[model samples]
Target: MDRRSRPKRHEESRENSRRNPTTRTIRREAIRLEDVWVAYAGSGKPAIREINLFFPLGKLVLITGPNGAGKTTLLETCLGLLKPYRGKAFLLGVDTKSRKILEARRKCSYVPQDFMKPPYESYTARQAIELGLVLENTPDKNTRVEWAAKLLGIEDLLDRPLGTLSGGQQQRVYLARALARKPLVMLLDEPFSSLDRETRKTVAEILRNYVDRENTTVIIVSHDTAPIIELADTTIWMNEGKVVKVEAK
Candidate 1:
């Protein structure tokens, strides 16, 4: 083509580019479980059965149910800490039973239901929080710790030994640890169990803010949902190891 024709072609290309801009597709599921069933050793029944669940990115999910309803089992199964006896569990698109599950877990932060430390344990609250940051090689770890502590109203306890603190206090410390990591996925099992009403509200606000600002995918298991119910994008109700209801707000 001549130079004049080349100029016209370039103009057409620019118009086409404007009309068809390149776009990236984001994966919807941060965690997925397909027909999962988890059973304890020598147990006659599965702890969780016929479970199929998906947690999308950038949303807060609340899992609520009575005790012995298999809420904890579901969370553990999603993290690959408990293998599904009958089905598949995936985290960040990687199968939970695969070797790459470790890599997938690096993008996750978890606070278990029992966060209390033994009296003989020696790590300070600040040090405990540091553990989460270590997996990600996060820079400015100290600053992140401070920020999380302050957010959780635990700044004064940073230097206190974790084992020396009360159960409620320990819960806050562990929550701060999880938040400091800034993980893409966060799983908290009965995180507010030991917290008082006021602290529960405060922590719930912190979690809601994190989800909004960071687009973090959060799955929280709690028997009490008042604190977080308004903030959850989805609420899952479980009974007898099955998800009986899923309500989207």
Candidate 2:
């Protein structure tokens, strides 16, 4: 390199140094499961058994398991969607299956594996987010709606009909609707099932920042390991409905 270019390179190096943080700090515990077990109403075998886990607050967690291995069952139990056959699920420091289930869900958001809405009804991306806030009876619904749309980069499609949007656009809108509540935790089921590789990476990157900035906990269920491993702080691998916890380096 020439002497004249050295100064410019030095300045660029300084800019990068100023932008990087060498250390990461953690502040709280987000999800804690203790000796939990879940079984279907009519099934003889348990879906998830003797599970124990502690997740750092604001951390992104990836959950991977085979079909029928209880990945869905675990998310449902944590969000108080299912009644546990035995043991406990402590989410946000409260028993998830107790009377507080409704309240617990208020601060939690979920996106199912598939997106299905009633036929013949028209909903714009913005309207769908608005409806979610209304369903939760959240105050400042408009602000929440605006923020959710913008955060997911769907503000440009606010007036576009949900059915008219592209697959990636539709997924982002679904994400915005879940984010409308400004929940403390987000549970996603098979988020990458239908997305292409680029969309998968983009969505994963956005989720990583969201978890960090909001101190929000995210637990995502996916069989695709690449995106999950790239974004997760820790991974919980399940087989036959049992979790194998490990810190990924």
Candidate 3:
């Protein structure tokens, strides 16, 4: 082979390596906050202050604190829904403040504290679950909806209108919706608020299984941690908008 041809062949080999699926790298931190602070309008103090936290992939993290302790603020900051007054937040290696964060946000699913709707609102459990996949244009939408409903033990409630269901039932439907997305990172706020003791235990086991099977990151905010405490890899306690302790369990 000619010398010129050898260089060209070497360049082509390098290009092939770059495009190889096996060569891809994974970021270690699924969610990270660096000295972050977030404040509400008309409030002199920040809701979360000088927080530095890291949540790695494929682990269950529990955040627990009293009301007004900024657990909600911390979750929102991680998702880029709340802008930081100082420092930075990153989700899946994408800076939360960056415009490109939308791409990262799409890889996450959130179930907020107030997911229940009024009795007059009319949307079936199946329809609500489908919406999560629909928003992302996920393929095999029907299959995913069915899978989520079954996983959450809500198959019987699928055709029932969400408003007609009890608060606990509605919570399960919303949780199914979040799971249908197959998200890389899950942020759940007060997920077990309305659940009975038995249902809470079931949901906690499901969440643990999800993290193990999918290799995803899960961050949960709850006042009652009994159901999920055993499954947690790390527990973060916050008070007055500051993380008072982070313990590995």
Q: Candidate 2: which stretches are off by over 4 Å?
A: 1-27, 135-140
Model 3 is weakest, by summed lDDT over 10 consecutive residues, at 20-29
- Highest TM-score, which number? 3
Candidate 2 per-residue lDDT over residues 1-249, each given as its tens digit:
599999998888667656632111112655778889989878888999998888767889998977887888888888788767788886666677666556557667888877755444389888877777865655688888788788777899999778777767777888888877777889998877767887788788888988888889989988878776977988888989898656665
User: Of models 2 and 3, which has the larger lDDT?
Assistant: 3
For candidate 1, give the lDDT of residue 233: 96
Error of 3 at 114 (Å): 0.8
**lDDT of the candidates, in the order given:** 0.88, 0.78, 0.89
Clashing pairs in 3: none
What lDDT does model 1 reach?
0.88
Give the alpha carbon lDDT tens digit for every residue of 48-81 in model 3. Answer: 9989988889999999999999999999999999
Please give the lDDT score at residue 99 for candidate 1: 81
TM-score, per-candidate, Cα-based:
0.87, 0.81, 0.89
Over 82-183, each residue of candidate 1 has an lDDT whose tens digit, in order, gives 999899998877788888788778778999987778997899999999888776665689999999999998999999888899999999998998998888
